[model samples]
Target: MVVALVGNPNTGKSTLFNALCGARARTGNFPGVTVEKKVGRLKLPTLGPSRSGGGGAAEVIDLPGTYSLSPRSADEMVSVDVLLGDAYGTPRPDAVVCVVDASNLHRNLYLVSQVLELGLPVVVALNMGDVARARGTTIDAGVLSEKLGVPVIPTEAHRRRGLEELKTAIVAAASGPALQPVRSLPDAVVAEANALEGWLSEHGCPDVPAYLRERMVLDVGGQVVERYRTRCTGDLPAHLGEVRSRLAEAGCRVPAVEAAGRYAWAREVLDGAVETTPEPAATGSDRLDRILTHRVWGLLAFAALMFAVFQAIFSWAGPFMDAIGEGQGWLSGLVQSAMPPGAFRSLIIDGVIAGVGGVLVFLPQIVILFLAIAILEDCGYMARAAFLMDRLMSRLGLSGKSFVPLMSSFACAVPGVMATRVIENRRDRMVTILVAPLMSCSARLPVYLLLIGAFVPATAYLGGWVTLQGLVLFAMTSLGAVVAIPVAWLLRKTWFKGETPPFVMELPPYRWPSPRNVALRVYDRGKAFVTRAGTLIFAASVLIWAAGYFPGDHTELHAVQAKMENPQVAADMSAEAWDALEERRRKLSADLIADSALGRTGRFIEPAVKPLGWDWKIGVGALASFPAREVIIATLGTIYSLGGDVDETDDGLRDAMRRSEWPDGDPVYTLPVALSVMVFFALCAQCAATLMVIKRETNSWRWPIFTFVYMTGLAYVAALLTYQIGSRLF
Candidate 1:
């Protein structure tokens, strides 16, 4: 049996789904719409008093939360089509579980009423029962069930309360009476629906249900019609026009009629079933929102919160990150000590270990970022953040809905692009997708940390309250968000020109975040990061190691090692001679790298990147990073591993980079070069995963290709300007 879990946004539908299915759920996409589909197995109880283990697991699908079945967006339309069994790859659900917020019965019932109109047996899951009771609200489930002709189960999903009851209700509904439409349309509206059904059949439209026929005439230019438009035959627009004209002539307006009728029936159904005391003058959420949502104070609070988060990522994660680096170094030493000196040992230590470690060492920051975001989202401040950003987004011709996805890009761009399904306007969604990657992702964190630590002085600002390194790191991340604004404007004005959709969002009440939810979310994010590190970054690292390692000449390397190990020469040599010998070794290492294929390729691209103040070595690292921004660290690790003969734990790469000099004896990597590199990485579209997701979301390679070209061009220009100006100033 198949069942769908449906509800309005913020109704705790997801929480209920998780409670029901736990870890049995899997995620995919709906047939035609790109919206995510979550399905899980719900093992059903037996029918009678025994309620034994006789039944099989029911497949429960969690549809995207939507306000109504009128279908404003593609995602919302998905709920309608799936319920009607019109969506491919999904049959009509055996029963529908309509989860609603118990505290907001009147408003929530509006959607429940629409679900009832679909002619499917619905078991109402009155979620947030605890919150409702806390607010002095009482819901008579039996009364609600009698009034609505379905089971109403009061559920506290977070506590796993009423789940068994909810399951039982689902089983009862599936086996009970056949359902009928709850809200009947007016005679005139009914007549129009009947006439339109005939016209639709003649035009080769599918045999839509009576309620769906009513929605067809109601929601003008909605996703439902757009979804099936390909199969529609013989002047669909004319048939729709005639039906709408007759309805309007009979005094039933198109969109308003549907809303008015649904809401009227909802209010009637909710009348005596829900009883609420007068709200207090100042609720806890209201008191907090007064400051958090204030125009001036909210902005300050948001900035402070972001600053604290970035600071924590830098300061708190330092020890853990260092330990990872040291651990990798120790493992490399153990392998080096045990194995005979050969190419395989070198590959294991230098290629695999160094490359993978470079990526893994940044796991602390990624975990911290995911934890913070999960906290914000779970505690309900994320919605307020969007509400705060909406004001600024409107001026740029982007919807407020775009802010959430854009902010999500900071963790990873794949989900950020996926989050664009919430955006109702096609133009707004595409524009948001185009610019979201400009927000610095966790992948770029390693680059920022490496460069900022190497170049920026670790001095305290504001009398030790702020560290300069942390501030620079924060600035680099913020720069991405800043640069995205103008790029988004340009894209809005040209490629995706359209009127911005009005932003409507609900700021859910603040509550202590559930630790379980937060942990699960962080775990999922960490797993995804580790998976990419093992696959893409690992492959790139090995490839880079090969390019930097051979034509297999270790003559110069052995000579340098022999000289360094000679105690007799060390005793005879003065300090200056010792320094000179070290310099010679460094120069020989550089020369060896230049002889390798990777170095040759870097030299070929050197002139092109010279304007940005990059040497051939930095050019190679930058080019290798194209597959993933995180791969730059691995690439650099592999480069320094093969070239400098240094261990991973020695902080050797940064030191080598600092000591690097041109043939003219000028420094290769200065503060200006570091800053320019950071700027470029901040804006570049480097992650192949992000590009792949963009292509999938857009359903075309054109947008991803365009994204790469424009972002790379923009990054080059920005880096060039930064380097030129910084060179002059510094």
Candidate 2:
């Protein structure tokens, strides 16, 4: 048997799903949309002859949280299609579980009422009953069940209360007959819907469900009508207009009528079944909100909290990242010991191990970021944060919901792009996704640090409170965000042009975040990055390795490395002779890289980059780092014959960069050139993993490709301007 779980946002629906499914849930995207599909297997008590004494197995699909079945976009239509068994590759649900917040019963019942009209056997999980009680809202579950003709199970999902009863109800409902459709609509509306259903069946869309026919009559310019119009033969819009006209004549106007009828039915059912006491002037949450949501204090609190989160992501994850890097090195060393000096050994070490390590190095930051977001979100502070930021975001043609995602991009754009799912408006979500990569992530830090430390003088000002190097670092760090404002405005004005929708979100009462749910969220996000984005990063890493390794003979280089590794050969030589051999090896390795495919491409683009004060070596570093911004440090290290293991701060590598020059003996390391490099990396979309995540989130390669092209172009123009202007002044 298959069961579908549906509910409104922040109603403990996901909590319930996690409680029931535990670690068994698997998350994936829907057939053609980015909306997540989570399915898990459940073992139910046997009550039928087929099961005998054994427990029965069922598959439970947790649908996206929605306030209503009236979908406005293709993504929103997915939920309705899945419920109606019309979604491709999804089976018809044997039963539906409508999870509702008991404290907000009246408002939540709007969705429940819609579900009741689906003509499917449903079990209502009245979740958050404890919260309802705390709010002085008492609901008579038995009476509510009798009124709706469905079993209502009161559940506190976080506390694991009432889950067994909910499961039993689901099994019983799935085996039972489908319930009669709720009579929420007026007779005229129902009659018109039935007539329209017959008309659609005759007009080529024979499989349109009865519930959908009612929706077509109720939802004005909704997804249902638009979807069916493409399939129906002729004049479907005219037929719909005629039916709506007759219904209006009978005083049953669409859209509004549906809401009125559903609310009326809900009120009638709950007339004597619910009791509420509202006497408190300010509850605990309200009292805290006074300061937390204050214009001044709230912003301060949000800033401090974000600072902590940023620190955690930047500083806390360092040890883990280093450990992963060390492990990669150790593994490479072990492979060198176990294998011969050849192309295969280099492939295993450089292509495979290095690529996989690059991907894993990001896991720590991703985990910490998702952990912080999940905790903040589950505890209810996220809504207030959005509410506070709405005013500012509105000016950019976005709601406050875009703030968190953009802020998150400072840590990494992968999770930041994923976080846009919270924004319901499609235009706003797309805008957020497009602008997210502009936030300078941690990966860009190495590039900035290397340039500032190398070129920017340590001149002090303001009694040494600020130094030129410090100022340069700060400017580079903030450069992307400063540039994003105009980019966002331009994007909104052109591609995603639309009126910014008013931000309306319910601030759920503050409570402790459930650990189980937080862990699940972190695990799911981490798993997704490693499994989906990791594969692409790994493949790109291998391709880049092959590019730099090929089109040049490495036999002599391998022989030099083999001789250096032989202790017997090294012991017989004097220190001077050993030093000369090492130099020879370094020179040989450098020559091989310079003659490789990537090197040739770098030279090919040197002319284009010359205006930005960069040579072919700098161009090569920029191109090599496309897989990740920080890879430029290692790439530069290799280009200078200092080995790929050197970091941005390595003295030898820094000195080599200082000593680098053009054919005319002019130094390559200059203030303007360093600034140009930093500016380019700051504005560029250089991370392949982030691009992959964007592709996955948008469900299209077009956006990622567009992002890469636009950002690279923007980077080049900005870099050229920075160098040209700075050179003349300095």
In lDDT terms, which candidate is top?
Answer: 2
Among all candidates shown, the one with the greatest TM-score:
2
Q: Once superposed on the true structure, which residue ranges of model 2 sit more than 4 Å away at CA?
A: 49-55, 198-206, 229-249, 278-281
lDDT of each: 0.78, 0.88
Question: What is the C-alpha lDDT profile of model 2 across 127-174, one tens digit per residue?
Answer: 988878887888999999998899999999989899889888888888
Positional deviation of residue 615's Cα in model 2 after best superposition, in angstroms: 1.9
User: What lDDT does candidate 2 reach at residue 538?
Assistant: 92
lDDT of 1 by residue, 1-730 (tens): 7889999887788778888887777765676555767788898886843222234568899998888888867777788889988789998888899999887888888888888878888899999887787778888999999999999999988788999999988888886666877764567777777777777777787587887777777878876566556677877766778878877887888878877877788888878988888874456888899999999999899878867776676677778988997999899978866765556777998789976785676567668767887788778897788788888889989866787677767766765776676575667888899999998887798788888878888899899999988888999989989988888888888877766777877777787777776776666556655663345556656776788767657676656656666678889889998887877766655666667777789989899999999988788878767656766665565555433433323377788778878889999898899999999999988876677667666756788899999999999999999999999999
